[model samples]
Target: MGKAQKNKTVGRAEMSGVERLGLRVSAMINSPRAQDRCAALIHRMEADQDADWEEVMSRIAETDGVSMVFQDDGGVLLEWEAPTDEDRVLELGEVEALEVEEAPF
Candidate 1:
């Protein structure tokens, strides 16, 4: 019984970062240039490379505290503990609603 209890906790399913991201991340990422300038620069640098996982991590390490980590399944994660004024979320970013066109008379 003790082993079964322990196993249950250890084997619990977890939500990967991508799964957690889902639809919410779309707005946050495209929040009208709300991304931190430095972070954006880092993102561009990574995008320009053909580097592998280790290389990406190494390049990201050059930045102060920002990091881009990819999950085994290629889910990306960007993390930075430091929050400067520019990084502040002034408001919840919004996604535009779909528009429907009326038939012409």
Candidate 2:
């Protein structure tokens, strides 16, 4: 078969874990409130010495109005959704959308 025909013969496949995570982050950035929440969470994570990047990502997903997928050190995937919180809404600073990086190592 020709290269084009060979490619067409392959079936569609599911997105990889990294792609799913990228989509989640993209959704958050597109929403002003969610973007702010994520940025604040990044700051919080940076401030904590013992925090794992993936775990911090999960917590960001948990804060009041966000959703995300995080891959832990064990190579397992975890999903989180924001919980309802009545505390003051966190203000988001100017957010520059990130260029999609290569998949998780």
Candidate 3:
């Protein structure tokens, strides 16, 4: 049988407005499939203090594997599929060291 997939959600309850926006923007910028226009918009957002936040959010909503829902409190809820055990990378550096006894000379 196939395993059930888990989803993760981030929102106003967990972070401030600026933090949430930063997370969303970072996700969009890191997406490999992001379009040139989106890149331009992101650059503009960085350069312009008065950039249109709604436009940035609308673009975020269009990202693959991501969804944004507007809340009644004027906040957004971001949801995406959580990584599974198969998605996790094993790091050799994180392995515990083995203790060895010194050989008699």
Best by lDDT: 3
Q: Candidate 3: lDDT of 26?
A: 78
TM-score of every model?
Answer: 0.27, 0.26, 0.35
Model 3 Cα shift for residue 90 (angstroms): 4.9
* Candidate 3, 44-104: lDDT as tens digits: 3343234446655767778787666666655555556654677666677644454567999
Instruction: Compose the digit string of candidate 2's lDDT tens values, residues 16-90.
Output: 554555455455455667544443111222323343445545655565644443335322222334434644454
Q: Pairs clashing in candidate 3?
A: none
C-alpha lDDT of all candidate models, in order: 0.50, 0.46, 0.55
lDDT of 1 by residue, 1-105 (tens): 699899998998996543333323444444545455422212322333344434544554686776766656545566656476776556434324435579898
* Candidate 3 whole-model C-alpha lDDT, 0 to 1: 0.55
The TM-score of predicted model 1 comes to 0.27
Q: Flag regions of model 2 displaced more than 4 Å.
A: 1-10, 35-105
TM-score winner between candidates 1 and 3: 3
Worst 10 residues of 2 by lDDT: 40-49
Better of 2 and 3 by TM-score: 3
Model 1: residues >4 Å from true position, as ranges? 1-54, 85-105
RMSD of each candidate?
A: 12.9, 16.6, 15.7
